[model samples]
Target chain A: MIELTDVHKAFGSKRVLRGVNLTIPTGTSMVIIGGSGTGKSVTLKCILGLVTPDRGKITLDGQDVTKGDRDAFLARFGMLFQGAALFDSLSVWQNVAFRLQRGAARRPKAEAREIAIEKLRRVGLTPEVADLFPAELSGGMQKRVGLARAIAADPEIIFFDEPTTGLDPIMAGVINELIREIVTEMGATAMTITHDMTSVRAIADNVAMLHDGQIKWTGPVAEMDDSSDPYLDQFIHGRAEGPIAAVR
Target chain B: MSGATLALAPVAAIGRLAIFAVRGVSHVFRPPYYPREFGQALMQIGWYSLPVVALTALFTGGALALQIYAGGSRFNASSVVPSIVAIGMVRELGPVLGGLMVAARVASSIAAEIGTMKVTEQIDALVTLSTNPMKYLVAPRLLAAVIVVPALVAVGDSIGIWGGYLVGVYHLDFNAVDYLKNTVNYLESWDVVSGLIKGAVFGFIVALAGCYHGMQSGRGAQGVGRATKSAVQAAAVAILATDFLLTALFFTS
Candidate 1:
C-alpha cells in the first residue's frame, strides 16, 4: 500500500498540489483522471520522489518513505513513462533489459538479454524487433517495449503514465487489455494516470478524479458512471456547464 | 535598480549553477559505468576532434617558428627556431589550443545529446528504472574524456613540433639535423608533464560544462541550441582560466 498525507507542492507562486491526501491499497489498480497540468503528474512524481512535497507524510507498506532509503525504495517499483521515453541510442531489447543488465538485480548480459526477449514475447513483440532502435519502431510497439521493460525486474509496484495517449482506438484497447492482463498476472499493485474513459473503464479497478489540486471523487470502477458528484458527472459526460467550468 | 535586487539575481543564478555542478560531480564517482557510452565519448572528444586540433596546433607552431626566426634574426642568432618551437608547442600551444578545439566539439555534443534526452523525458525514464541520471549518463563520459585527452595532447604536441620543424628546416633554410637536435635538446620532462596535466583538467572542464548546461536546458529546440552554445563557451573559459593558473603553479619563471 502507498499513502500520502497532506502533500503540498508549489512551483514559485503557483500551488500545484494543495494538501492532497490519498491511499492506494495493495493489489489494486487506481487510475487518477484529470485535465493536463492539474498536478496529476506532480502527484505521481512526488510518490516517485522526483519532486519533493513541502510538508507531507508518504509511506509504502506502512514504512515511512518520506525519508526512507531511496534506492531500496525505488527498487520495489517500475514505471512506464508518458511519452514511452525510450533511449534512442539503445536497441529495443537493450532498453527493455536496461534494468536487468544495469539494474540493482545485477544479472549478466546474456541472462538480461534472454529475460528481455521473454518479456517482449509477453508484450506480443517478437525477438527480431528487439534488435531495432526505438526510432525504428512504431508508437504502439514502443509502448509495448516500455511495458516489457517495466516488468523486467519483476517489481512489486508499477506506475503507468497515460498508457493510451496518442494511440488509435483499437491500439488503445489492445494496450488496455494487455495492461489489465499483466497487472493480474504479475499480481502487482498498479497506479495509472490517464484521461481516456475507455482506458479507465478497461484497466481501472478503482477510479479517482483529480480536480482543483485535490481528489474530487473516488470509487470502484463499476460505480464511476453512477456517481452523484456533479464534477464526476460533468467530466464523464463531457458536458461543459453545470458547476464545472472548462477553465478556472 | 535596487542593490538588493541586483545582488539577488547573481545569487540565485549562482545557486542553481552550484546545485548543477554538485550533482554532476557526485555522478562522476558513482556506479553503473556505461562502457559503450564511455567509448563513444572518448571517440568524440579525443579521436574525432584530431583534425581540428591538429590544424590549430600546426598553424600555431609554424607561426611560432616564424616569430622566433624574426626575433633571432634581430639578434643575429637565428639558430633557436627548433628549440623555441618545441618548448612552446609542448608547454602552452598543444594542450590549450587542442583543449579549445575539443571544447567546440565534445562539449556541444554532450550538451545537445543530454539536453534532447531531458526534453524527451528519457532522463525521467532512467529515474523510474531506479537509475540515477547523473551517474548513468554523466560519469562515464567524464571519465573517458579525462583519460583520453592526455593521449590526444601528446599526439598534438608531436604534430605541432613537426609543423615547426617543417617551417624551420625548409622555409627558414636551416639544416634538418641542427633543427631536430635543438628541438630534442630543448624538450624537458616538466614541459611534457605540464601539457598532460592541462589536458586532464581541460577534459574535466569540457565534460562538466557539457553536462551542466544540458541539465539546465529548458524545453524544445531553442533550449537545445542554448545549451550547446553555453557548453562550448563555458568549456573554453574554464580551459583558459585553468591554463593560466596551472602554468603559474607549475613553471613560474
Candidate 2:
C-alpha cells in the first residue's frame, strides 16, 4: 500500500499541491484524474521521489519512501513516462534491457536480450523491432516499447503517466487494455495519472479526482458515475460551466 | 535590471559554475565507473575532433611561418622563421587553436545532446533506472577529455610543424634539411610539454562547460539552444583565459 499524508508542494509561490491526502491499497490500480496543469503529474512524481514535496509524508508498504536506499527503492518501481522517454541512442531491446544490464540485478547480455525480447512480445512488438531505435518507431510503437521497458525488471509497483495521451482512439484502447491486463497479471500496485476518460474507465479499479490541488472525490470506479459530488460530475461529464472553473 | 542586481548577477553565475565544476570533477574519482561510456566519449571527443583540430593547426602554422619570414627579412633575420614557427606552434598556437576548434565542435554537440535528453526526461529515466547521471554521463566524458586532449595536442603540434616545413621548403626556397634541423634543435622539450599540459586543462574546461550548462538547461527548444550557445561561449572564453594563466605559470611564474 502507498499512503500520502497532507502532501503540500509549492514551486516559487505557485502552490501546485495544497495538503493532498490519499491512500492506494495494495494490488490495485488507482487512476488520478485531473485537468491539465492541476498537479496530477506532480503528485505522482512526489511519490516516486522525482519531485520532493514541501511538507508531506509518503510511505510505501509501511516504510517511508524518502528515507531508504534510493537504488533499492527505485528498483521496486517501474515507470512509463508521458512521452515514452526512450533513449534515442539505444536500440529498442537495449533500452528495454537497460536495468537488467546494470547494477545489482545485472544479467548476462544474452539473457537480458532474451528477456527484453519476451517483454516486447508481451507488449505486442515483434522480435524484428528489437534492433530498431526509438526514432524508427511510430508514437504508438514507441509507447509499447516504453511499456516493455517499464515491466522489463518485473517491478513490484508500476507508474503510467498519461499512458494514452497521444494515441488514436483505437490505439489508446489497445494500450489501456494492455496496461490493465499487465497490472492484473503482475499483481503490481499501479498508479496512473491521466485525464483521458476512456483510459480511466478501461484501466482503473479505483479513481481519485484531483481538483484545485486536492482530491475532491475518491471511490471505486464503479461508484464514480453516481458519486453525487458536483465537481466529480462536472469533470466526468466534461462540462465547461460548473463550480470548478474551466480557466485557471 | 538595477545596477546592484546587474553587478551581483555575474558573481552568482560564477558561484554556480564553480559549484558545478567542483561537483563534476569530484565524480571522476568515485567508484562504479562506466568503461563503456568512457570508451564512447573517447571516440566522440577525441577521434571525431581530429580533422578540425588538424586543419586549424596546419593553416595557422603555415600562416605563422609566412608572416615570420616576412618580418624577419626586414631585420636581416629571415633564418629565424623555422625556429619561431616551431616554438610558436608548440608553445601556444597548437593547443589554443586546437582547444578552440574542439570547444566549437564537441562542447556545442555535448550541450545540445544532453540538453535534449534532459528536456525529454531521459535523465529522470536514468535516475529511475538506478543510474546516476553524473556517474554515467559526465564523469566518463570528463575523464576521456582529460586523457585524450593531450594526445591530440601532441599530434597537432607535430602536424603544425610539418605544415611550417612544407611552407618553408617549397614556398620560401629554404633547404628542407636545414629547416628540419632548426625546428628540431631550437625547440625545447618543455615547450612541447607545456602546450600539452594546456591541452589537458582546456579539455577539462570544455567538457565542464558542456555538462554543466546542459544539465542546468531549462525546458523546451529555446532552452536547449541557449544551453548550446552558452556552452561554446563559456568554453572558448575559459580556454583562452586559462591559456594566458598557464602560459604565465609555465614561462614567467
Candidate 3:
C-alpha cells in the first residue's frame, strides 16, 4: 500500500500541490485524473522522491519513502515516464536491462539480455528490436519499450505517467490494455496519472479526481460515472462551463 | 530583471558552479564507478580532439616563427627565431590555444548532450534505475579530461616545435641543423611540464563547465542552446584566466 498524507509542494511562488492526501490499497490500480498542470505529475514525482514536498508524508508499505536507502526504495518501484524517457545512447535491450546490469541487482550480461528479451516479448516486441536504438522505434513502439523496461525488474510497485498521452486512439487503447494486463499479471500496486478518459477506465481499479491541487473525489472506477460530485462530472464529461475554467 | 537581482546574479552563478564542481569531483572517488563511461569519455575528449588540436598548434607555431624572425631582425637577432618559437610554444601557446580549441569543441558537445538528456528525463530515468548521474556521467568525463588532456598538450607542444622548425628551415632560409640545435638547447623541460600542468587544469574547467551548465539547463531547444553557449564561453574564459595564473606562478621568479 502507498499513502500520501497532506502533501504540499510549491515551486517558487506557484503552489503546485496543496495538501493532497490519498491512499492506494495493496494489489490495486489507482489512476489519478486531472486537467493539465493541476499537479498530477508533481504528485507522482513527490511519491518517487524526485520532487520533495514542502510538508507531507509519503509511505510505501507503512515505511516513509524519504527516510530509507534511496537505492533500495527505488528498486521496488518501476516507472514509465510521460515521454517514455528512453536513453537515446543505449540500445533497446540495454535500456530494458539497465537495472539488471547495475547496482545491487546486478546480473551477468547474457542473463540480463535474456531477461530483457523476455520482457520485450511480454510487451509484444520481438527479439529483432533488441539491438535497435530508441530513435529507430516508432512512438508507440517506444512506449512499449518503455513499458518493457519498467517491468524488466519485476518491481513490487509501478508508476505510469500519462501513459497514453501522445498515441493515436488505437495505439492508446493497445497501451491501455497492456498496462491493465501487466498490472494484473504482476499483481503490482500501480499508480497511474492520466487525463485520457479511455486510459482511466481501462487501467484503473479506482479513480481519484485531482483538481485545484487536491483530490475532489475518490472511489472505485465503477462509481466514477454516477458520482454526484460536480467537479468529477464536469471533468469526466469534458465540460468547459462548469467550476473548472478552461482558460487557466 | 531587477538591478539588485542582476548585481547578485554573477555571485549566485559562481556559488552554484562551485557547489556543482565539488559534488562532481566528490563522485569520482566513490564506489560503483562505471569504467565503460570512463573509456568512452577518454575517446571523446582525447582521441577525437587530436586532429583539431594538432592543426591549430601547427599553424600557430609556423606563424609564431615568422613573427619572431621579423621582430628579431629589428635588433639584428634573426637567429633567435627557433629558440623563441620553441620556448613560446612549450611555455604558453600550445596549451592555451589547444585548451581553447577543446573548450569550443568538447565542452559544447558535452553540454548539449547532457542537456538533451536532462530535458528528455533520461537523467531522472537513471536515478530511477538506481544509477547516480554524477557517477555515471560527470565523474567519468571529469577523470578522463584530467588524465588525457596533458598528453594532448605534450603532443601539441611537439607538433608546434616541428612546425616552427619547418618554417625556419624552408621559409626563413635558416640552416636545418642550427635551427634544431638552437630549439633543443634553449627549451627547458620545466617549460613543457608547466604547460602540461596548465592543460590538466584547463581540462578540469572544460568538463566542469560543461556538466554544470548542462545539469542547470532549463528546458527545450533554447535551454540547451543557452547551456552549450554558456559552457563554451565559461570554458574558454576559464582556460585563459587559469593560464595567466599558472604562468605567473611558474615563471614569476
Candidate 4:
C-alpha cells in the first residue's frame, strides 16, 4: 500500500501540488486521470523520491519513504517513465537487465541476459529484439520494451506514467491490455497516471481525477460514469467549459 | 534585479558547482564501479583525441620555432631557436593547447550526450534502477580524464618538440646535431612535470564543467544545446585560467 497525506509542493512561485492526499490499497490498479500540467507527474515523482514535497508524509507499506535506505526502497518499485526513458547507449536487453548487472541485485551476466530475454518475450517482443538498441525499435515497440523493463525485476510496486500517450489506438489498446494482464498476474500494486479514456476503461480498477492540483473526484471505475461531479463529468466527456478552465 | 541579488548570483552559481564537484568526486572511491564505462571514456577522451592534439601541437611548435628564429636573429642569437622551442613546447604550449583542443572536443561531446540523457529522463531512470547517476556517469568520465590527459600531454610534448626539430634543422639550414644537443641541454625535468600537472588539472576542469552543465540542463533541444555550449566555453576559460595559476605557482620567484 502507498499513502500520501497533505503533500504540498511548489516550484518558485508556482504551487504544483497543494494538500494532495491519496491512498492505494494493496494489489489494486489506481489510474490517475488529469489534463496536462496538473501535477500528475509531480505526484508520481514525489512518491518515487525524485521530487521532495515541501510538507507531506508519504509512506510505502507504512514506512516513511523519505527516511530510509534509498536503494532498498527503490528496488521494491519499478517505473516506466513518460518518454520510455530507455538508455540510448545501452542495448535493449542491457537496459532490461540493468538492475541485475549491478548493486545489491547483481547477478551473473549470462543469467541476467536470459531473464531479459524472457521478460522481453513476455512483453510481445522476440528474443532477437534484445540485441537491438532502443532507437531501432518503433514507438509502440519502445513502449513495450519499457514495459518489459518495468516488470523485469518482478517488483512489488510498479508505476506507469502516460503509458499510452503517443501510440495509435490499436497499439494503445494492446498496451492497455498488456498492462491490465500484467497487474492482474503479478498482483503488484499499480499506480498509473494517464488521460487516455480507453486506457482508463481497460486498466483502471479505480479512477481518480486531478484538477487544479487536487483530486476532484475518485471512485471505482464502475461508478465513474455516474459520479455526477461537474468537473469530473466535463473532464471525462472532454468538454471545453466547466468549473475547470480549459487553459491555465 | 536588486543589487544584493545580482551580487549573490555568481556566488550562488559557484557554490552550486562546488557542491556538484564534491558529490561527483566523492563517488569515485565508492563501490559498484563500472570498469567498462571507465575504459570507454578513456578511449573517447584520450585515444580518439590523439590526432587532433598531435596536429595542433605540431603546427604550434613549427610556428614557434620560426618566430623565435626570426626574433632571435634581430639580436644575432638565431642559435637559441631549438632551446627556446624545446622549453616553450615542454613547459607551456603542449599542455595548454592540448588541453584547450580537448576542451573543445571531449567536453562538448560529454555535455551533449549527458544533456540529451537528462532531457530524455534517462538519469531519473537510472535512479529508479537503484543506480546512482553520479557513480555510473560522472565518476568514470572524471577518472578517465584525470588519468589519460597527462599521457596525452606527454605524447603531445614529444610531437611538439619533434616539430620544432624538423623546422629548425631543415627550414632554417641549422645543423641537426647541434639543434638536438641544444634542445636536450636546455630542457629541465621540472618543465615536463609541470606541464603534465597542468594537463591533469585541465582535464579535471573539462570533465567537471561538462558533467555539471549536463546535469543542470533544463529540458528539450534548446536546453541541451545551451548546456553543450556552456560546457565548452566554461572548459576553455577554465583551462586558460588554471594554466595561468599553475604557471604562477610553478615558475614564479
Q: Pick the DockQ winner.
A: 4
TM-score, every prediction: 0.94, 0.97, 0.98, 0.99
Pairwise lDDT winner, candidates 2 and 4:
2
Task: For each candidate in the order shown, give its overall lDDT on alpha carbons.
Answer: 0.89, 0.93, 0.94, 0.93
Per-candidate RMSD, Å: 2.1, 1.4, 1.1, 0.9
lDDT per residue as tens, model 1, B1-253: 7999898997997788778667766777766567777787788887898888888888888999999999999988788888889999999999999899888989999999999999988998888787888788788777877888888898889999999988988899989988898899889998999899999989888988898899888899999999999999989988999999999999887
**Residues B123-184, model 4: lDDT tens digits:** 99999999899999999999999998999999999999889989988899899999999999
Candidate 1 local Cα displacement, residue B53, angstroms: 2.0
lDDT of 3 by residue, B137-189 (tens): 99999999999988898899889999998999999999999999999999888
Flag regions of model 3 displaced more than 4 Å: B1-5
Q: TM-score winner among the candidates? A: 4
For model 2, what is the C-alpha lDDT against the true structure?
0.93
Ranking of all predicted structures according to DockQ, beginning with the best and ending with the worst: 4, 3, 2, 1
Docking class of 1: medium
TM-score of chain B of each: 0.93, 0.97, 0.98, 0.98
lDDT of 2 at A61: 91
Ranking by TM-score: 4, 3, 2, 1
